[model samples]
Target: MMRVGVISDTHLRSYDRDLAKKLAEHFKDVQMILHAGDITELSVLDMLEAPQVIAVLGNMDGFAAAQSLPAKRELKLEGFQIGLIHGYGPPNGLEERVRREFDDVDAIVFGHSHKPTNYLLNGLLYFNPGSAAGGRGHPKTVGMLTLGDSISGEIIEI
Candidate 1:
């Protein structure tokens, strides 16, 4: 099985050692890491302890982060296709907006609402690990995806 770590909405202007340490512990076993966006700086990505790190540009990202990342991306892993994006607009209906961005994918990973969501709908897996930095009364969280015979997700409070 392949394991992947998912996180978003860090909103950090610089490196956060404490956050990094937490991520290192929570995501220690993952082979890849996905940052759904709102990462204000690129240094934040370095905290993840994974072989592969994929990320997108969120509305709140700074100029350098925006230039280094895409608004959306796709990946093919363990026979499943996955889409990653940083959602936009209001929290309500944020899933629908991100859903419209990709096609023929088994799952969509996104962040923007700072809400943790993991469920299967219409054969698609919609996952949001919430905000790792914690904001707006939401508890800090992250996510894990295990890919084998099928794909499954787990939201981890950090």
Candidate 2:
């Protein structure tokens, strides 16, 4: 199985020591790391210990480090097509907006709501790892995606 660690909305200006420790402990076995955005600093990626890192630039990321990062991306992992987006506008219609943005994707990973979500809608998985920085009263969390014969995932609260 392929294990991918998913994180988002880490609005820290510098490396977060607690977050680094948590990642090292919990994501030791992950093959890849996905940052859904709002990562305020590019150094955050350098601090992670994953073999591969895939990310997008969120609305709040305006620095040079985030300048070249795409706003959206599509990747295939273990034969499943996954769409990555940082999201926009209000949270109420966020899912619909994402669905409209990508087609033929098995799963859509997004952030910006700072709320954890793991559910299937119209046969597509909608996952939001919440805010890894614990912003807006939401608990700090991340996600794990296991791909094998099929795709399965979980939102983990840190």
TM-score of each: 0.98, 0.96
Residue lDDT tens for model 2, 40-156: 888888767888999999988858656779999999999999999999999899989988889899999999999898998777999999988887778989999898997778999
State the weakest 10-residue window (summed lDDT) of model 1.
40-49
Clash pairs, model 1 backbone:
none
lDDT (tens digit, per residue) of candidate 1 on 1-158: 99999999999988889999999999999999999999988888888789999999999998998788989999999999999999999988999999999989999999999999999998999999999988878899999999999999999999
lDDT of 2: 0.89
Q: In TM-score terms, which candidate is top?
A: 1
Stretches of candidate 2 exceeding 4 Å from the true structure? none
> Candidate 2, after superposition: displacement of residue 37 in Å?
0.4
Where model 1 places Cα greater than 4 Å from the true spot, the runs are: none
What C-alpha lDDT do the candidate models reach, one value each? 0.93, 0.89
